[model samples]
Target: MAEHVTPPGIDIGTMHPARRYDYLLGGKDNFEADRASAETLLKFFPATRINALENRRFLRRAVTFLAREAGLRQFLDIGSGLPTAPNVHEVAQGIAPQSRVVYVDNDPIVLVHARALLTSTAEGATAYVDADLRDPARILTHPDLLGTLDLTRPVGLMLVAVMHFFPDALKPYEIVDRLVRAMPSGSYLAMSHGTFDYLTPAKRAELDALLARSGEPAAPRGRAEFARFLDGLELCEPGIVPVSEWRADDEPEPRPDPAEAAVYGAVARIP
Candidate 1:
């Protein structure tokens, strides 16, 4: 682990909903409040862990593709949760030793863990920014990010399993638009979002209520709505699809499960 340098007045003891997500993922860095909230979430959606894992797998695959196939070397990972296995930097740098990565998140807990666990590869670079997604300008102009990446060139913008945190009121689409505008042409936006397309109306209602009680905003959108986020962008081959079915590994196909994990994965390039 690296050194822990938390921003001023940031406390990890008091739990937040995102922290609870870290707890539910079997991480040891979350507080009691987060644990309680995670328990409540699990009671309503028992497949929450599976959903999270699948989303994470999607993130890894996207990063790998960007580095190995797309010839991209810089990455901006917004709403980065607590550092987990095969993080963006790890996957990208593993493919190309010169890859550079900048992780952005407002959670102090995530900051602490990111500083302690996310290390820059000897041939590359990695840094953490204590910022929120709502402040895209702050993220795009922050000294840490500017110093780490070159905005004049193409960079991969990863928003894995995080946009759902922002509701319609926050103008999540506009936020994405701003970031897209900031990046140069050929930049990629890889996103994995949660949706209720797979759930029954009653079950969706039950989960929505549970999230409200847990202080989380549910932003499950249909394919059309999700596609709007990439309105001016060029979607990569295989457009948006179920995460499990997105470029699945080359091996004997496993039996398909009927239960869908309310999540969609897609990668698009700015024109």
Candidate 2:
């Protein structure tokens, strides 16, 4: 695979979730540590690449639904990873040119690349906030976010392929609810989280041990545990299914089984 020059000051020895995800998606912005961690993950979950692509496809479909069906024009995407094609703004603006997007991530590389390269249309607006997902208030109140998106209005909150990094100790549920509470009633929330529901008990144990050993912070919860993030929200159709099976009408034919993807995905509206 191709590689990009690491930006100065980044700890290249450590594995970053975004870079590991980019590596999984065949991108060129990962380091040796990231690739090694990804390969180690593949040992317990052989379909790691398929799971990553499935989650990426799920994010695109959710954004399309929000832009077209949900009639949302503003979006706040937290834990936004490396700049990939068809980003939140790219997908949203394609459906509605006036759509506004605020991408948030703690990774300096993501922030630098996104701010430097990500563009917006004349009608729509785009901005990047250098913040961590754990600090939802900071992201919601960032000057760049406020300048770009009006929080008083309904916003599509996206937390795709990123929550797995925050295990129970991080209180992921509370973090999600805090962000949701900042938005209006009609605002929509779209998320895809890693899940161990499809894995056997032994496999789950092995995966957990592997992650601990590799210093990878991937904590894939079960279905019931993952559902807590969307509690009290109005779930869209086909709620809480594997990312590969959630609204696969536009996906390529012969979708992968839920076990292969091993991630729960859904879209909901704050009521």
Candidate 3:
């Protein structure tokens, strides 16, 4: 396979959502600009790191459930950020070695690191598509996506923590609908979206200003609005809750406060 090269037009001086997320996850792949923006966001939303961690945990639990319990063998993870430990392929292929995965992201930095996400078990397959989420048609038609995943079969559509980047003008709900429509029946939608429901009006305003200043404005939704994204699908048990509490395993330590997580997650199946 060819190595991914970063495009020349990327602006390293400005913060990108994926890089900011990496910084929040304590990863070293972020630049100074991303770190600065993350620090500012932390000032207003003190639970930024907690929210990121909980979202990641939700992703893992969701994928595990799809692979082991749901008997899913294919995954389409859009807006998959920089390669992280225990990635979708890792979690899924660990349970069923024949699983196949296609990861999609538009970030040039993520493209440069796509090789890391391409690793697959001997019995499985993994590929990456360099496309934006706003263009669902382009993403669905990408050669890499078409080659790796069989659209005729059921797939686990992983949309974790990336929808907030799409402003309402982008019709994120419609984009999700398009993707879900393309998948066959019995396909699953596993997603986690950021929400401002936990923040006060003052803090929400501060968050908006911080994002605007950083050039990465987001559209955090409320519970009802977030639930609308899964409209045509059948929600699994314990639907649409804070990330930390979504089918969480019993641990010796107390779970983090749901308010600190500030992100809603759910797994729904297309009937």
Candidate 4:
């Protein structure tokens, strides 16, 4: 087993977005602080757990579409959370053994468990870069990402359920645009972002308050605002629908309620 030393500037006492998400996904890599933060959100919006699960499922489906359908051989997954079953590499390598992946996240815990992400098929490759999404340049230029994936080729960029953390001041749209611009013409962007479109004004306010109290406030965008993230890219079929409805493998089975799964998912080509 490989070991990764916890880097400086990590405060375990404070709640971290990745750890909170890990707890939401039923993973044991979270602390009490993370749990408390997750519980707070659930109290305000009972559908949060369901939404998290649906968003995760959407990620798997989108990756499958990119690797198995789009024939993309490389992936650059930004803000990739704690290691979970059927991860990006597993799904992609399962379809095409030659697939390559680069997982990027700023969380120290993610780095500690990065060994799980490093396991790749004999023909494929996997690497982890400890970087923040706010710094697209750093992530794009990281040696591990560059070593594992060829930027010149079509790469699937996964940004599932992660961008909401960036507020307007951070210019999330520009950040995503910069990343998309870095990829080749055929590269695809598979994204799922949290939204308040389904919530009542009161419920939305309560959710916002809870997020602020947690010390990591997130800005849940509306449908129109979220669509702007893919401005220059060409959207794929079943465009910008709720996570549960975006090219779902289990169709006609009464998809999860959009209100419960308040996250929008889509895939777009750079061209």
Candidate 5:
């Protein structure tokens, strides 16, 4: 059973924790319950706000690489969260101005926000699909996606900061496989996944408790397990690394151990 709360600006009946995360990120559209949940998360992890910002930064950089450096046009941003500034479409289209992007999320709140924020330039197109990562077939065959993206052409698959929700039961690897198999060769798979590599026993326990309280799942993977998702694809230079360390041009300020940050980011090309 789920509770219902009507946000002031948004009419989503029951919001997901991820939607609450958007509120924590300083977006104006989240409801009272979302704000409450976000506050609870901050009490558990004070650096969560900063971490979310860094992850958003990673999104911008990855999209730039895909659009400007790799010359890819179409994008499939699965699990794309609230419409933050410089979204995948904003970053990619800023570069080429003709890059088509399809944003996917299952949350009704996210769907409303997407319709509000996901406007495309005249030269390019942008559309949002209400679909879950677990439903790869529905997501891939979504009408809006098919109309905007050419399956035969290479596409950038953006799976940033969303796979941690899938526990072993869902077999996240197999889900990625289904989506990858559908894309043509030369397509890129960009991901930023959360892991438990750096958490102390006590801290991990605390996080686990928090997730349970909020009805969200926390399934953080290790470096080896994270690497397994990219087994067949060719990883870009620097391979898998901390979200803040990957292709970082400037020297990054020293922070907690890799396991503490507990997040990995990488991009791979399909053969």
Candidate 6:
């Protein structure tokens, strides 16, 4: 892994979402800027680390369900953070070695680690697209993505823990709609998003003010608002719920409280 290698043109002083997420997940691929930002965020959202773990667990369960149960052979993982163990391709290909995955992220460091991620099972394939989630057109039309996976067939579209950064003002719903429109009827969308729905009004206000002051773009939404991204889709059992509770059999006992994590997760099939 070339994680220690600083990719050219990356700003080491600024904290990036991918690096901050890696920091939150107890990964050493982050710099001082990312750790500092995570510490500041932890001041308000004290359960930041637990939330990261719960969200990661949700991703594993959701991807396993998509690959093993839903029988999805191709995956498009938008906003895939720094290379982590049991990545989307690893999880999917483990269940079905023929599965193909295309990971999307604009982080330069993640792009550098693309070599490690691109290594797949002999029967499976993996590709990386160094693109921003904000640009749906670019992602949907990327040559790497097109070459790796066929959109006309069923695909497991993963937007896990990513949409919250894109507030309503960014036309997040429209971005999702465009991506969903390209998928076939049998395709599935699995996502997990940060939420303020479980928090007290005062706590939400404090977190909101803190983020505004810190210039963090995180916009935690309510369950209903988050579900808007899956509108017109067939919701899987256990419909939108706390990340820790979404198909949590694989998780150990003593799951974190929804109020503590405050992140919603769900998987819906495109009809």
lDDT of 5 by residue, 24-54 (tens): 6777766667777778867987767766766
List the global CA lDDT of all models.
0.83, 0.89, 0.89, 0.88, 0.83, 0.90
- lDDT for predicted candidate 3 compared with the true structure: 0.89
Candidate 5: where are CA atoms >4 Å away? Answer: 1-15, 250-260
The full ranking of all candidates by TM-score, starting with the best, is 6, 2, 4, 3, 1, 5
- Flag regions of model 2 displaced more than 4 Å: 1-5
Cα deviation of 141, candidate 4, in Å: 1.0
Off by over 4 Å in 1: 1-17, 251-258
Q: Which stretches of candidate 6 lie over 4 Å from their true place?
A: 1-3
User: Could you tell which candidate, 1 or 6, scores higher by lDDT?
Assistant: 6
* Count of steric clashes across candidates, in order: 1, 0, 0, 0, 3, 0
lDDT of 3 by residue, 1-271 (tens): 1343446767878888888888899787777788988898788888889889888989989999999999999999999998887799999999999999999988887887777556999999999998888899999999988998999999999999999888888999999999999999999999999998987788888887876876665888999999999997899989999999999966325888877899999999988
Candidates 1 and 6 compared: the better one by TM-score is 6
Instruction: Pick the lDDT winner.
Output: 6
Off by over 4 Å in 3: 1-7
Q: In model 5, which range of ten residues has the least summed lDDT? A: 1-10
TM-score of 6: 0.97
TM-score of 1: 0.92
Residue 199 lDDT, candidate 5, scale 0-100: 74
Looking at model 3, which ten-residue stretch has the lowest summed lDDT? 1-10
lDDT of 4 by residue, 1-271 (tens): 1343545767868888888888998888777788888898888788888898898889889999999889999999999989888799999999999999999998877887886556999999999999989999999999988888988999999999889989999989999999999999899999998999988889888887776776675888999999999998899998989999998867557678888999999999999
Write candidate 1's Cα lDDT for 172-203 as tens digits: 99999999999999899999888788788899
Question: What are the per-residue Cα lDDT tens digits for candidate 2 across 1-271?
Answer: 5566667668888999998998999888788988988888887789999999989999999999999999999999888899888798999999999999999998877877898878998999999998988888888789999999887899999999888888788888899989989999899999999988888889888887887787666678788888888999999998989999888987778899988999999999998
